[model samples]
Target chain A: MRVCVLNGFDSEEMTVAQERKLEQELEVLNQKGDTVDYFKLRDRKIAYCLGCWDCWLKTPGECRIKDEQEDILKSFVKTDHLVFVSNVRLGFVTATLKKTMDRLIPNFLPYIRVYQNEFHHYPRYEKTPILHTRLIVDHTVERDEIDLIEDYFKRVALNFGSDLKSFKIIDGKGEEDYEFADM
Target chain B: MLICNGSPRGEMSNSATIAKWFLKDQDKVILLMKGPKHQEYLDILAAYDHIVFIYPLYVDAMPGIVKAFFERVAIADGLMAGKKVSFIIHSGFPESVHLEVLERYHRILSKKLGFVLADTIVIPGSEGFRLMPPKQNRKKQQDVMKLMDQFRIDQPFDDHLVRRLAGKRQSNKMRNFIFSLLEKTGITNLYWNSNLKRNNAYNKRFDKPYTEL
Candidate 1:
């Protein structure tokens, strides 16, 4: 299966050891009969959703504003499974992941119905499940914060008609145990 | 009132309208948008004595710029430590169960970063109601006015009123929606209830101290 792993970790200042550990984890997932492709969102300048509702009424399956959203949407459509890995900031998902999700809303056009009182959406893919994982780098988060973030991820996955397959909380000890070759 | 408009929609936003109600008669108010700011705008935020963050909840949490603003404030740690802080969160859901998610964020900031969190007001989206227009905007304004009246600048917080208010406004619609959404989305059966239990089992695993990287 083609498994696209989008790592939102700001890799520009990553330590050598941290980089190796992330690579190892991806390798492990890859070795397990899954093809992995990753994107670092910090390198890209993505805009937030304007809530124009134009995507639903006029544009149909595309956002009105032109930016990196179109390209990311194209990539998501072609992939079988999507993985979002990021470092937790202030007990929440990184801004990069949040922005990426906001940008992807246009792809759900026609398939999703959002009213004032309720939101209804058809499954994007019948057989293909979007499996997501939020790997938090231990240093910047607290235990309660992690709990809140985990719950947020689950809620989001449910909202998107997707599944949160797993949550890997990597503290210092588990850092060395991550094997990316198996990805 | 400090209104943090994180939605890209700007003025038409349901949350912004609510914030406006609270700003009545106030000589100074800080309206911070995500991408639009001149040096003067930044200076205004720096001059605030108390902050009231009003924003739409995205993905069960505060918007990115809301978090980013705290990071950019540089003095957030010092300013928030003993200062009055509150939230007016607007969401599309009928109930505001997701407000807990925001409270969780505040808890982290208060406990770890030394910010003092005051009362939080949550206004559920007005979508399916029969008689009312979207009252979130109006309600938010009234709510902030009420909060200001209830607030005592020099006194310690009275937990009784806060708890009573939070309890009275609690809606089961949000809880039901979260569960229903999970099942409707096909992710409900992916993991067993046991897995859910295990995920929340804090003490079963090793008791190693959590280290911040």
Candidate 2:
């Protein structure tokens, strides 16, 4: 299975030990015979969605902008599993992860459909992947904020047509939890 | 009043058109677009009579930049403690119910900053607002004026129009099939195709640029 790991933590806040642990976790995944592509979003160039429906109507399955998003979109569509690893920034997902999500309109058709008794956009691809999030939260993270994060991801899962398997909260010592995730 | 337009499309945005009506009083409201430049105005946000946030919903959430702005405001907590706030949220979805949780987020946000959430205007089907007929647009503008007039008297916005503005939560499968038929008949995509043709990018419309396929 193909997996995409998005580390939405910025440079200063991400500790070197945590980074290494993250790498170790990915190594374990690789050793288990998985194809994992990890991206540190802080070093990548991603633009905010302009609310232009070019990707929807004019261009059916792609964005016109010449950015790194095409690669991201391809990975998102091809993968069976997509993992979002983020540190809470001011009670929500880091801006990097949000930016990444904002640019995913290309994956959805402009046409609306009734899914699960709610109106949702039609999916461009044939199948939906399983979604999971590993949120690294600190003491400053409010309980309400975590709830908001869970709610936001649920909405994302709905939009992507993915089953949200789990949303695990981690500090520095919760690497063992990754073992239990569908990984 | 301080109006912050948080649409990523910047100044020339659907949010801007909605804002034009709300800022009808020329001398009172100052419109600011969300960008790095607005960070400098943090010092002045507290002094405004009220702050109006106009934004488009992106994937059931605020645009990333607007999310960033919210984080900054939270970091600078109490900067607008005594001020009141209002929200005008629009989206491409046909139903306004998609925006409910986001409204809850803002209300909680208001409480965090000690600001009052005076009113909220949630608009769905905003994609067609730009192409709306003049008479219909006039009526919508008038509806906006009624809400603004109430706010002018320092009263909150609790009008019957809220339900009307929300549109339908869902349509029957037959209507969905009809919409699908419209999509295939090219009626729904005429506007999009024309723009694509104008840009000389029509042939490339279905280009899968990055895929191995």
Using TM-score as the measure, which candidate wins?
2
Over A1-183, each residue of candidate 1 has an lDDT whose tens digit, in order, gives 666666666434543355467677677777786766667678777776666655544544557788866666666666676777777665566667777776665555223333323354443333334656656566655678777777777766666666777776766444555433333
- lDDT string for model 2 (B160-179, tens) is 76656666765667776787
Task: Give fnat (model 1).
Answer: 0.25
Candidate 1's C-alpha runs over 4 A off are: A14-16, A24-33, A109-128, A172-174, A179-183, B27-31, B36-42, B74-79, B126-144, B152-213
Among all candidates shown, the one with the greatest lDDT:
2
TM-score of 2: 0.88
Can you give the lDDT of residue B70 in candidate 2? 75
lDDT per residue for candidate 2 within A1-183, as digits (tens), equals 788887787545554556667778888888888888788887888777777777865666778786877678888777788888888775678778888888878887665655765668777777567888888876667788788888888888887777788898887554545652365
Clashing pairs in 2: none
RMSD (CA, Å), each prediction? 11.6, 2.9
Error of 2 at B159 (Å): 3.9
Best by DockQ: 2
**TM-scores for all predictions:** 0.74, 0.88
